[model samples]
Target: MVENEKDLKDLETEQSALSEEETSEQHDAPSEKNESSELEEALGKIASLEAKAEEYETKLLRVQADFENYKRRARMDAEAAQKYRAQSLVSEILPALDNFERALKVEAADEQTKSLLQGMEMVHRQLVSALKAEGVEEIETVGKPFDPQFHQAVMQAEEEGYEPNTVIEEFQKGYKLKDRVIRPSMVKVSQ
Candidate 1:
């Protein structure tokens, strides 16, 4: 009968230990679940912040590109303004140059008139030099092929030595400001 009592006490103690172990396992499972939820929430916040950062970076790049383009356009405009600044004043002086050229072509009748002609010639040369310094150039028309851009054909002539559609005579001189033709040469073309 004593042996049976001892065996019953041992079994009860074993069952109590097993129950405590099960309770510990249940508490640990809830703690693991809480930790997993916290980890998921932190990952979600990180992902949101990363997306916002990328959006801001893209906006910054676009703004920087726009600013660069604006700067380039402004620079181009300023350069063009500087290049063409003398265009209007040069245009106004071209007719005066033509008149001076016509005056130089007249014949002097006497020694007194010849001295006056020489003085006028000097003035005309000085004017031409001044214009040349300001980037003015005379367009060549005589003996060359007739180009509509630089030469305007006022009359057609039949000349034996020249080819057809060639410039035979220049009636009025043409001038260019740099590469641009301010006035086209008035010419006669051989047919």
Candidate 2:
């Protein structure tokens, strides 16, 4: 009976010890919960930062592409400006060229005048050469088929030994600046 009583006391002490341990664990649980909430907040911040980074990267790429397009457009505009720089000057000189052609067709009166005319002819040739070097060229007219792009038919005539719609005579010469026609040829077309 005394041994049984000692065993009961021992069991009571063990039960009390287990209850105290459970209370200590309950007291530590709030700190573990705080840690878990902080970890969740940190993970959410990381996700938000990653989304912002992706958005910024997309904006950066769009800005870069826009800059490239702007550069290309600017370059093309500069090239066009440079290419057409001499257009006005060339246009102004064409009428003078027509006058020179008319003067060359007239017969010289005497030897002195003939020499003067020859000098003028040389000057005209030099002018033509200079214009040619600047990308000006005479449009072909005589014997070629009349084309509205380069030739203007002033008169039509039935001519033998010539194909219909062929240019038989050029009243005024035509010229081109590069691939573009500056003036159309004034011509007589054989019907």
Candidate 3:
């Protein structure tokens, strides 16, 4: 009877140990599930932050490119303004130059008139020199191929010993300032 009681006690102890181990395993499983869920949440937050940072970086690059383009355009406009600064003044002086040329072409009848003409010629030379220094120049017309950009065709004639569309004569002179035409030449073209 004592042996049977001892066997019963040992079996009861083993069963209690197994039940304790099962309770511990159940508690550990729930803890492991909680840890996995927390890790997934953290990873999702990290991905969202990374996406926002990437979007901000893309916007920064675009704004930087737009600012650079604006600066380049402003620089080009300043250069253009500096290059054409003398255009308006040169235009205003062209009619005076034409009148001077007409006055210089008249025949002097007396020595006093010739002396006055000589003084006028000196003034004309100084004006021309000033214009040349500012990059103003006359366009070539006679005996060259007619270009509508530099020459305005006032008349066309069938002339011998000249190619068609060639400039035969220039009635009014044309002037340019640094490759920009202030006025086109009034010209006769051969047909």
| Global CA lDDT computed for model 3 | 0.84
The Cα RMSD of model 3 versus the native structure comes to: 24.9
Evaluation by lDDT, superior candidate among 2 and 3:
3
Segments in model 2 whose C-alpha atoms lie over 4 Å from true places: 1-33
TM-score per candidate: 0.69, 0.74, 0.74
In candidate 2, what are the lDDT values of residues 102-186, reduced to their tens digit? 9888788899989989999999999999999888999999999999999999999999999999999999999898888888999
Best by lDDT: 3
Candidate 2 shows a clash count of 0
Tens-digit lDDT string for candidate 1 (20-97): 754764464334357778677667656855765675576557557666776798899998777666778888988888
Off by over 4 Å in 1: 1-48
Model 3: per-residue Cα lDDT over 113-183, one tens digit each: 99999999999999999999988999999999999999999999999999999999999999998889999
Question: How does candidate 1 score on lDDT?
Answer: 0.80
Report the candidate with higher TM-score, 1 versus 2. 2
Please tell me which model should have the higher lDDT, number 1 or number 2.
2
